[model samples]
Target: MVKYLDTPGGFVTKAAASLTLDAGCEFGGGVDCGSQYFLGFMAYHRAWFLQDRLALTVGGGAITNPGRYLVLLPPINGTTAASGTPYFTANPGDRYRAWDFQVAADVIPRPFITFRVEFNHRAANVPYFSGPGGVTPPGGNQGAPGSLVDGWSPDLVKTENRLTGALMVKL
Candidate 1:
């Protein structure tokens, strides 16, 4: 479960928790990318490959973005005078991205092994943090600030498509 909020327009933002665990093939540990909004359903990707070095290979997969999570916050309040509390606040009911498609490719090293490559494209969701203004929180009216408020927004959520490659050997 990932929970974060972007600032209004581009004022202040906060990303509290983004937890994920794959639990790989042998219960070792699958692939985990922390967490982030997908914009539309055409964001985020996950795949598998079995290759070596020579044999050419190709495959296809799909994508499903969780959606954008945005929020806005004021500065300093989690403390008293100079320092007291050291935690941030993230508004709820943030935006969520949609799901998209994914592509795959690979290079075979040996008959028994091969290499892999993948490319992913995520749609763009609304810019959560821009600079707080007429935009209101999802839950209707903007929530009230805590005793202390101190933070920054416009925190860019990076989902730049990536070029993946790999090398494998056969026994």
Candidate 2:
């Protein structure tokens, strides 16, 4: 289920959740059954002042995936969804969780243009975010896609903080 609310100078909220169930047999005819769940929620308030020319917003959200089947695996070593890497295996039933807080200010000089600056801080229970060294290998991608090279591993961290600016236009 999912829900969303949007109103300038008012409270906004959103929530989404999903579940997956799998029941089948493995290649060796062994029983394989499992269930995964994911839930997330976020809420924010947009306050408009100065004749509605400026606005401020603050919001936060959290997510939990008990069996991280829904989590996106980092593309280390030029890996892709179809070709997974061995450095960080995301098998079913693995735990992955994250939360984040954000604050943003927007300037709406005209009805069609908006400038925004936002700051965000996110954290995870496991090493999920990319680190300063990045996810690429030392000498770029080598060997087959998603395949490992000797003595090399991508950098991953548990926390991240960033500031971003964007210009939005609504035609």
- Best candidate (score: lDDT): 2
For model 1, residues 49-70, the per-residue Cα lDDT tens digits are 3312222223222232331123
Q: What's the residue-level lDDT of 78 in candidate 1?
A: 24
User: TM-scores, in order shown?
Assistant: 0.32, 0.76
Candidate 1 off by > 4 Å: 1-91, 127-159, 169-171
As a TM-score, model 2 comes out at: 0.76
- Candidate 2 stretches greater than 4 Å from native: 1-35
Q: Local distance difference test, per candidate?
A: 0.34, 0.72
Global lDDT for candidate 1? 0.34
Best by TM-score: 2
